[model samples]
Target: MIGNGTAVEINARKGIFFEVFLVFLKLGLTSFGGPVAHLGYFRSEIVEKRKWLSESNYADIVALCQFLPGPASSQVGIAIGMSRGEWRGALAAWTAFTLPSARALYLFAQAMAAASGGSSGGWLHGLKVAAVAVVALAILGMARTLTPDRIRASVAAMAMVAAFVLPSAWGQIGGIVLGALFGMTFLKGDMPSAAAALPLAISRRVGAVLLFTFFALLLGLPLIAAMLKSRDLALFDTFYRVGALVFGGGHVVLPLLKAEVVPHFVSENDFLTGYGAAEAVPGPLFTFAAYIGSAVGGWKAAVVCTVAIFLSSFLIVLSALPFWNDLRNHPSARAALNGANAAVVGLLLAAFYDPVWSAGITNRTDFALRIAASLLLFCWKTPPWLVVMLCGVAGQVFM
Candidate 1:
């Protein structure tokens, strides 16, 4: 009964979904260097190579995801998938991208549960150091392309200073908001018209329903769990809230997860061990939830917790995409996005200095090693996975 146009759209959507799944599955296996570096990889693969979206559109997506309270890079991927094939594409992207790391961490958690201790080796430190180099290169590349004008450059610099001074989630949020405001005032002149809007499968009505569900669970889950006194429900509620509320994802989720899980459900040692192991993996740091869950209640609990943590985030994105598709076409929205994009560069730069650089670069020898890794990545154009392997081996041998 479907018209030819409708049937063609359906077929195209299915094709796009499969394509997105394969691409992200490949990335999930190989994309290293944490969330910031994942953004870089996405830029290279989706924006530069595949030409799925323009550089400006990609940056706009990054800025929007950064503004949201979830895994920024993963959320960006979801948005990319949504643009390509709507809600189904978003789910495919998330699944393909998240599955490899989630499975690895889950298996690791099971192994650690069987063993006495978890992995805490010099090689792990090397992976963290490699993350530093990767983020540094990303900052350099994004700054060059995103902050071309002095006005935008100033916005980035100011955002960096704000993030450095505050050094928290709120600071990052403030920086992005300030950038949008600054862009509206200073960067607004002669702005180009917005790009053509992408098609989304979900309607505004459906998006609204999903959004309402997101808030309903956020507010109602705790009350219901309290009434029932169910520990399982409580656990899901806690992680779901964490996914819903935290900004500056990846490492930023650490403190929140620690506060919620440690000493109450799992030991501090186990939690820290899992966190360290998460660094060596190649996908979103949120997968640490699986490890923590396994330590607490085995594989079933691991699946439960991982799904709980990621679900709210997916819901929020699905809810927002339909609306964002329209809002992004407005001139003021485009201007604000320009400022937000510059701020994203600054945010990554600050992240590089604090957690990435400060944590990884401890000594002159570490400094030299990181510099070498940076050269391999930026100048020599080495593969990231290879660089990660080499640096990890070097860390095991030297450090």
Candidate 2:
């Protein structure tokens, strides 16, 4: 009851739409520290400052988007826009939210590659450490919040173990299957209250489909061509695949990405470094692909890679909403979501071992640092932006 059709408190001023655009654009420009920061920023600006959505509505939307794939903040931004104006407002919301950060990443990738003198070293190391720490914290926070019931927690525990032990693709697929089975078998419950309450219109479903199809073409055609000839698979393949497979949230994308891109070229060091830089930026962490792309190719590669990742992520986010909405609508599917949510813990656990813990936790001193870092994020509530910057500088200076 605050802005547009049926919703009633404010007038739909042209000025307000422009203001919304500028506001999120600024957030996109200044927002760094990954999804947690993005959500925090959204709460501070939209809910607290702008008073766009009531706190209950905001929490409901956040929970809904978390269950859906792609970027939760991005979806929340689109939903906020729709609540205010309409379809064009949604478009404007995504554009302003995404473009500035995408541009920043492209340029940043170019700069990093140039600064590193061809190989990614220097700041990249610190960035990787920061990324691993941040993601680990995220998985922990999400698990605590999402999985409450005993049956759901058990499912999540299994998912976490499977994600940790199974090969990345196999483990993720296995987790999803396990979640579905758990939902179908046990964990009976009512549908989440928020699922049936969404305000989207039927017409906008077409927009979602179009966006989904665009990325499908971008991803599917390349693989098909790879069969005919040695089609050059670049950043597109990894990011596109990462976008498609990642079901839970931004943190879920990390391990899948680690598997996809790390094996192709460079070392784990370079991979994590890019991830850190992505964390330090705004929008979505998937834009980490730009750094990888640029490192692999050049500015052209960075541009293409940035577009590919963004489009891939955008489409997946759009396509999954309906299914997610439907899934949350049922007791059985809701149970499954709960189970799947738990598995995220296992996935993070696995990631900690192989990539984060394995790489960063070398000696007792390093292990202590990591623990300190986690506490800084979780207990001290240190902002990730400041943490990442300090870490990058520290890695440059000492580690």
Candidate 3:
């Protein structure tokens, strides 16, 4: 590793583990505005300023992570860390970049739980309202980007309708699968040439083994947990499955989580409050998992849930790294991704309407506040965290 006053250059063998850790640690503390904003921070600090990787390299990693399940920004950080210091770098990068928000959310959940006692408060309602605006904004922006063409838009709409009909986790998964099939059947079209292939340290053989482990855990954990009747294992399985299946990003993960946790492990009010509170935090929105974990079973659950949620990103990213180029070049695979992306929008739409809109907007006052927050998000282009904070305060004052 060497630094030219302007930038830091890291290679495979140098002692850059700590440097990489610190850079991402700073980002974890300061990188707000959700995943897209997180990506911008990574590009500015790691790419343009630090010179750790090229623009194309970052873009390629972003593309691959977006295709895979889990948090794309965190995975991008892990991938860049891998390039710098192999597994050690990846571990360091993920820890530093993820830990800050995770810890903050865990503490916040604990604080809210302690303060609220047995009764819900106006602030909780405020947070729920914040979720209303944030998710609405997310759906609109994602639809514009992911479901741009008519076919994909239709896929999104149908997926939303199906989710409404089923109203469960199975519905969300089914929607994604159907969208993929639809895209493969109808959306295949022109393709851009593939980006330069990433140079990976993991061999094809190791990738295969890790890939097998990923599937084995995915398929077997549920059975193992069921046979043993262990709630801990069951919790882990729920989060792991969610991490593996979620397609669009963090916002889409909300509905899947609602299906899994609400009315069982966590209450409806707690869930929405956490969802709204998550919008106010920095780093990847996925740290919202930490809040859920803490709510159910304290710090232990917090650690376990956090690991379960993110473990797939490590296994799948490394496992798929060796084979990504071949897959990326195939038109069929790309078309399926297009369909899945559209379905992701639908899933968000479904989630927004039910748990988000329905729970948050109970009265005329709540509805008016949500509209104002949405306008702040859309027309004024206010930062999300600020909008969320203002909503919380408004919920306290007005309703």
Candidate 2 wrong stretches, greater than 4 Å: 1-17, 47-60, 83-87, 116-123, 147-150, 194-199, 204-219, 228-234, 316-327
Better of 1 and 3 by lDDT: 3
RMSD to native, candidate 2: 5.3
Better of 1 and 2 by lDDT: 1
Task: Estimate the lDDT of model 3.
Answer: 0.86
Question: What TM value does model 2 have?
Answer: 0.80
Please tell me which predicted candidate would have the highest TM-score against the true structure.
3
Give the 10-residue window scoring lowest on summed lDDT in candidate 1.
Answer: 189-198
TM-score of 1: 0.68
- lDDT per residue for candidate 1 within 313-399, as digits (tens), equals 888877876687556546676677678778777877776665567677889878888999989988898766577777788888898
Query: Model 1: residues >4 Å from true position, as ranges?
Result: 1-93, 109-119, 189-199, 214-305
> Per-residue lDDT for 242 in model 3?
88
The best-first sequence of candidates by lDDT reads 3, 1, 2
How many residue pairs in model 1 have overlapping backbones?
Answer: 0
